[model samples]
Target: MTRQRYHHGDLRRALLSAAAEAIAESGVNSLSMRDLARRAGVSHAAPGHHFADKAGLLTALATDGFQQLAKALGTSRLASNSLLELGVTYLRFALAHRGTFEVMFRTDLYHAADPDLLAARQRAADALYAGMADLPDAPAVASEEVREVALAAWSMVHGFATLWLSGAFPDSAAEDPVEAARVILGRVFTLHAGVIPSPEAS
Candidate 1:
């Protein structure tokens, strides 16, 4: 591969972009720092300069993914003001950022204890919990109850996205993932509504 020079700050970004593309095309197990440097048109040691090793690169990628997810959820919440819409947005992000999505949750692939990664993950969690708080009919529940509801909502969307990505769904569902998700989420929300106590009861 021809070695191309990148401006000081650009090298890190370029290598990260290449890593995401590589992981998306051939899963994380097949990814290598040498291949990433080659893909980025840089010296073999270039990626190492920015990321000490493959784990470091993945940690950076996962951190970015969580940050992006948090922003997407926050924007959806502000714009639509609906937990249902937030779920849809979450699915959309998972579909659109397949490479990052694949790595973000796999703790073994990255440095799970990295401060930046932890902070980013927390931001995403906070955003999801905030969405639960905004539900129109949702009453003022205890923190534990709120956490449980948030987890349920997160599980629903994350499970659906993971299954869809792995081709677990039929062709018909794949053809219109957004609509498919809307239908599934609607049912989940409907069932969920029965469990949450009314404001008067709360």
Candidate 2:
């Protein structure tokens, strides 16, 4: 008997979800279109209907990953609290969604030139920086100062997460990497002000 195909609403999302899982389990290099379709409980052609190929699927995943990450980072209401919170959230998301996180940042795996994907990635970064505006005395800092601070913070958290995920950290390090990231980021950003311009007196 011929197997029935899925036609339910939101098949695209379902496929992406399945694809993320597959990537997480075996890495992007091992993921295949047929594998995704199998995991999604759909016919092989169904994935093609939504995403023409593996590259297309990866592009969509990257776009979706950025949008979701932006939302996660922006969930904190207080702007003053956003920077640290966003960094924590970023590390948490990466640790939890390793597959999606890896593909989202690897431009070579996806069609990064796609306008929608590029825009989504930009929006993610913009949201992160916007949170910085909530700083108590940010405007007084020069543009370069802000960039320098932001890059430094990004580097610290990004490096920590990468090292933890890559198994470069000591086993004795706390298993909860997110907590470690928060503590480290807090210490780093707090002292970072001294490195930047002091706000002018009111």
Candidate 3:
């Protein structure tokens, strides 16, 4: 394939976009800087100029994914202020950005200790936890109880997204993932209504 030339500052973005496409088509294991360069219409070395290696590229991709996820969650929180809505948004992000979602959690695939990656991951986490606190029944202050509730909520949504993406759901449930997720997540919140005991109760 003929190499395509990239503008002065477009190569990095082009390479990242190509890498996502390649991961979606094949898998992370099959992705290579050389292949990404070809897909982006640049010299093989072009990718290296931006990303030192495969891990570097994947790290950058994961960072971008986390930032995007955080923004989506923040938007949902503002528009609906509903925990269920936040959970649904999480699922939607995962399915829509399958390639990035697949790479985001696989620590073995990238430099897990990278500062930017860690910061981005924290931003996404904070968004989810903030939604929990926005709930009407949330604790009055940030405490161990609040953290526990947030963790449970995160686990449930994250698990559902992972399972859905891996094709683990049957045809019936898979037909409408958003609705299915809504029902499932709704029940979870309902089951744990008033999860954090009120001050009056204590």
lDDT of each: 0.85, 0.76, 0.84
Please, what are the lDDT tens digits per residue for candidate 1 over residues 1-202? 2343475468887887888899889999999999998898888987877899999999999999999999999999898887778889999998888888999999999999999999999999998888476577343466669888888888999999899988898774537888998888876785567654445566
Per residue, candidate 3 scores C-alpha lDDT tens digits across 75-190 of: 99989888788889999998888888889999999999999999999999888787476576443446557778888888899999998877888874538999999888887776
Task: Output the lDDT of residue 33, model 1.
Answer: 92
How well is each residue in 19-55 modelled by candidate 2, as lDDT tens digits?
8899888888999999887877778887878889899
The C-alpha local distance difference test score for the whole of candidate 2 amounts to 0.76
Residue 44 CA displacement from its true place in model 2, Å: 1.6
Superposed on all Cα atoms, the candidates' RMSDs to the truth, in angstroms, are 4.1, 4.8, 4.3
After superposing all C-alphas onto the true structure, candidate 2 shows an RMSD in angstroms of: 4.8
The clash count of every prediction, one per candidate, is: 0, 0, 1
